[model samples]
Target: MTLTLHLDAAGWREHLQSVRNDVPGLVPVAKGNGYGFGLARLAAETSALGVDTLAVGTSLEVDQVRAGGWDGDIVVLTPWSRHDPVATALLGDPQVITTVSRVDDLTTILELNPQARLLAELLTSMKRHGLGRADLPALRSLAPVARFEGWTIHLPMRSPDPLAEARELATAAQAAVEAPVWLSHLPLDDYATLRSELNVEARLRMGTALWLGAPKTRRTTARVLDLHPVRRGERVGYWQRRASRDGWVVVVSGGTANGVALSAPTSAASLKQRAVALATGALDASGHALSPYTIAGRKRSFVEPPHMQSSLVFLPGAAGVAIGDEVPVELRLTTATVDQVVDE
Candidate 1:
């Protein structure tokens, strides 16, 4: 059976409004598993925002968005030199703005299809694709051959400072090209300030903040796969950490496949907070109580590490709980893989 994921349509709409209010001209990011809402739904939702452009991850995803009848400028974030079929996506002029990172790719795009829109990518995080600012002059010099739309920078998710980086990018972009500048994958809070600081016409390709900005708008949950009673002296599981007291051992139908570890930490912490994860991992090593269970709609501590396609959890005396019950799970939609959406 497929795992069930619930989404708050109203909640998502509310979050969308909040983002738009904060950043007047917001470009919502909708790519990859639709951030758990699926592409069709996000395309439909974002189309309602009246935006001229929406960012897709790649060419394959272009069809996913196009199939839904989203008639807008599609900016594919990945570089155009992404293999054959992908590279060919850059050859078409059907409203796709392909990224050109290298000086060679610039000539390749124009030679293949001079009609296509080419937005030069400056080197940023992920270290893949894009020309360096120092090398930007060569590409800018080729603007006459290609239909240069603007400049773009892919900032780091783990960087300590993004605005400063944005400023540097703007300065470098000023030297390279005069077209509108764009950015990909930056924090939502940083956008308005950065856009203000730059004080020019700029665009940001947003994914999480636009789709998963408000936590209450989306949530994920899985079915209780199995349950068993445990005794105080009962020896159980891989690590054998023995039960401190009698309780119920439970299991849920969710693991890595469902984007379990796709997390976005609070604030701008580059690294994840290890306090809870380490404690949970330690419990799994101890091999005593299970970890993935819920009572009265609350997550339970795990007894052991999450196994393939499932996780074990321990429930310590919650009222009227049982097997096969759909427990409430607190998943960060901005960070979790969404399996399904329940329109509300």
Candidate 2:
């Protein structure tokens, strides 16, 4: 039994190259399941793209990139801290650029490795992590001691006018210290406009859009391990919930361990979406949750919660499925951990 991601190799490569060409100074981000293609695969793809730098979410991922044959620079997106031994250990590596969000962290980093290459992350409206505007003055004083690579700002995805905010922040960062600006979550057109308007070097850190933007280029599927005919009201699965209709207990290869039925907190922005989410939660509470698996051209419902390595989905009546059939699965690639990726 297997859960696999099927990739159109030629189409995927073409898409990657197209994105790379469209976005000037594109830094492919390979972190956190590598956007479902895996870190090593993305690292290898980055090498194939011939990009000078690859950005990871944390310092711990540096070794994975290196092991995947990425000989160029690796930039850790997470802010550097003295408490993180992995981040501290990477300070001396010239090829690794650590993001310094706080002024005091910069000083400590400099004391540890004066020649450490650093990226200054300016605080954006996201307010997640970064050096505040007030901290910029202090940053200027200590920036020269370290190899200051550039400035980075992670813009929020849901904003009225992110370009305007990015322009303002980029301007502020330049005012403090004139350096290249690295950004995230900005559209390609907006990034181009910003680069032209600012007249400064800029790079875009891309993850989802770069890898999984073209959904047609990839497909995820799970192999059907077994199927058992069950009548209505027959108890089955771990919870032993009675079947709602005459159907088959279809066990497929994918579960929580493989990121099936697992979801990150939803950032539902609209009233309708929130209402729909509440409805879904209510259904789940009553044991009528929808499964991601698609059988006979329709999404099925889970008979019960998924097991460690398999899921039992209810297939009502005869739906033309078999023991070794591969059914399509819809899931977030970033959160999925498939057994194999077959590049056709």
Candidate 3:
């Protein structure tokens, strides 16, 4: 039994090239399960793209990128910390560009490596990390001692006017230090506009939009391991809950270990969406949760919470599916850990 991701290799490559063409100076981001393709695979793809730089989430990923055949510059998205041994150890590597957010971190980094290459991140609307706008001028003093490759601003994914904010921050950053501007989450048109409007260079660091942009190019499937006929009120699963209707208890590959039935916090913005979320939660609380597996073109309900390597799906009598069949699975790609990836 296997949970597999199938790829339309030709279509995926075409989409990747299209994004690269649209976004000039694109720094492809390969981090955090590598957007479901895995970090090593993404690093290899990044090498194929021939970009000068690749951005990973942490210094710990640098070795994986190197092992995957990426021999270019690597920029760690997480800000440098004096306490992180991996980050500190990478200080001497000229090809690794460390992101410095706080003024004190910059001081600490410089104290350790006098000529460490750095990317200064200014505080954006996201406010997750970065040095405050008031601290921008402080980078000027440290610029001489260290190599300031660029200034970065991580804008929010949903913004009314990302271009305006990016332009403002990029302007401020350029004023403080004469270096290229690196941006995240800015729209394509806005990035182009900002790049043209700004004095120094501007580069877009893209993750989801770069790798998983074309949904049609990939498919996920799980193999049916076993099936058992069930009648109404029949006990099933580990909880031995009574079956509500006549159906087949279908065991399929993919479970909690592979991120099946695991959900990220919902970003329910509207009242209707929030109400739907609440109703879904109510159903889950009642042990009537919908499974991601689709059998005979219909989504099935879970017999119980997923086990480590497989799930029990309640397939009603209306659907016809047998063991050993490959069924489609709808899941958030970023969270899924599949057994294999096949090029179709």
- List per-prediction Cα lDDT, in the order shown: 0.72, 0.91, 0.90
Query: lDDT by residue for model 3 over 125-243, one digit each (tens)?
Result: 88899988789778888887888898989999777899889888887877888899999999998889888887788889999998999999999999999989999999999999999
Tens-digit per-residue lDDT, 196-307, candidate 2: 9876799999999999988899999999999999999999999889999998999999999999989667789899999989999998998889999999889999999899
Write the number of the candidate with greater lDDT, choosing between 1 and 3: 3
TM for every model, in the order presented, reads: 0.83, 0.98, 0.98
Taking all chains together, the TM-score of candidate 3 against the true structure is 0.98
Q: What digit string (tens of lDDT, one per residue) describes model 1 on residues 22-77?
A: 76656777788787778888898878877888888887888889787688988888
RMSD to truth, every model = 3.7, 1.0, 1.1
Residue 253 of model 3, lDDT score:
97
Q: Rank the candidates by TM-score, best first.
A: 2, 3, 1
Cα lDDT, model 2, residue 251: 94
Q: Which numbered prediction scores highest in lDDT against the true structure?
A: 2
Which whole-number lDDT from 0 to 100 does residue 273 have in model 3? 95
